[model samples]
Target: MDNETLQAWVEQVSRDSFGRPFLHQATFNRRLRSTGGRYFMRSHDIEINPKQLETFGREETEKIIKHELCHYHLHLTKRGYRHQDADFQRLLAEVGGSRYCSALPGQTKRVQPYRYKLVCRSCGMEYLRKRKVNPAKYACGKCRGKLFIKMLDFVLEP
Candidate 1:
């Protein structure tokens, strides 16, 4: 949806869920990554990730709107608005907002597997390492045995 519609929707949701009118701007932010929405403390403006709507549709997007509104309203009223604050938690639960802002599709960080392994020649103990390291510098924690480094050729599936 367009910014106008999003703005209207945010205002309506603010009124309906929080019983407070949203006076600040609400817009779709294309540059937002990982997070589904954001509430700017300085401007009191709310930015919704357009990718969220495209990926999850209106039902889930409404929850994200609620989440941002929780931050917006609490921050404006001089109450605790941060994620760790009790007031924010209470209001968010009352409004039925998403527990956490979900990452957009294909926006989650990928984990790289270990590229090397250190083996204890005397005790058969093994240690996985993310990067190449000299085995001569370290000894096995259990047996203090001599160690050898082995490069791994593991591939990660998408």
Candidate 2:
């Protein structure tokens, strides 16, 4: 949807859910990623991730609008607006807003296993590392000795 439609939707949601009018702008922000929406504290504007609508459709996108509204309303009223605040959490739960702003598809973070080890030449002390490191830049903590880096073979468990 366009900015005008988003603005009207946000206003309607605010009035229906929070019993308040949203005076600021609401727009589709193409740059938004990971999070479904964002509420600007300073401008009091709400930005929805356009990708959310494309992926999840209107029903889910409405929930995201509610989530951002919770932040907008709570912050404007000088109440607990942060996600950790009781007021924010209670309002969000009461309105049935999404717990999280829903991650975009294919945007989840990946975990990398340790593939290298730093071994102290003198003491044989070893430190597992996820990335390659220059041994010359670091010294062994136990004996302050020169360290050498070695690749480790990892076997996946069945």
Candidate 3:
């Protein structure tokens, strides 16, 4: 749950699974949202997503830690450490690590609404846009006429 316990667990997993000692630090990274864990190539440190533990519990989190450890051990030994590499894949399978982490519920990216619209005054052509743009910087493609921007109103229906 905490950093210290995570560090000890990572070291233990490294030794038990890979027969290699994990010398680097392992900490719970609160900022990690999309992935279960990350391995730093430069620092050789491992970061576990705390949300994974809270969501999936210890069993799934341990697999994520093993996944990171695969990268750690292979990279340090000058072996194939990337996801596509044969060595990494073999090691991962041998350790029974998870190939991909599951996405957290309600973590999907929000779709941006079309908040603005560009209108051609001459041709009455319109373009829906998600971001606001300067009307002076753009021209209407249909008639090469002047363009004006308007804010679109959203009406929520029951």
Candidate 4:
């Protein structure tokens, strides 16, 4: 969506979901490759990754908006807005927003917290991996069958 449309959407969502008005700008940032969207602390503005909408569609993008709104509203009200904050967690869960900022391409450091994982097609075993490996070249450790990759969200240390 264009900037004008995005701004309107953000404002509408703020009123509908949080009972607050979003006074800052909201625009799509093509360069945001690490997550679905972000709320700038300095500007109180919101940025949505265009890739997020291209990949995940409108519904998911709306969730990302909700996620960013949680940050915006909480921060403006002087409540907890950081991901680890109890207030942030509670508001996020209550709103059913994305638990983590969703990932994007070329953002390796935060791409996937677990560099690797193995899922057994037969037994459904999930193994967390810290190092990357060729999924096609490896077999499930538990079933000795083909394995699938399961990436985890990056969790910053408290």
What local distance difference test score does each model get?
Answer: 0.90, 0.89, 0.92, 0.83
Clashes of 2: 0
Q: Residue-wise lDDT of candidate 1 within 1-158, one digit each (tens)?
A: 89999999999999999899999999999998878889999999999999989988899999999999999999989999999999999998999999776676567587877878899999899888887888888999999999999887784332
Model 4 residue runs over 4 Å out of place are 101-158
lDDT of 4 by residue, 1-158 (tens): 79999899889988988888999999999987667888999999999988888877887888899999999999999999999999999998887788765565555573534555668887888777877666788787767888878665664231
List candidate 2 stretches off by more than 4 Å: 110-117, 130-158
Candidate 1 off by > 4 Å: 31-33, 101-109, 121-124, 131-139, 145-158
Task: Pick the winner on lDDT between candidates 1 and 2.
Answer: 1
Best by lDDT: 3
Candidate 1 Cα RMSD (Å): 3.6
Identify the superior model by lDDT, candidate 2 or candidate 4. Answer: 2
Best by TM-score: 2
The TM-scores, one per candidate, come to 0.72, 0.77, 0.72, 0.65
- What TM-score does prediction 1 earn? 0.72
Query: Among all windows of ten consecutive residues in candidate 4, which has the lowest summed lDDT?
Result: 149-158
Query: What's the CA RMSD for each of the models?
Result: 3.6, 4.1, 3.9, 11.6
Clashing pairs in 3: none
- Order by lDDT, highest first: 3, 1, 2, 4
Off by over 4 Å in 3: 110-158
- State model 1's lDDT: 0.90
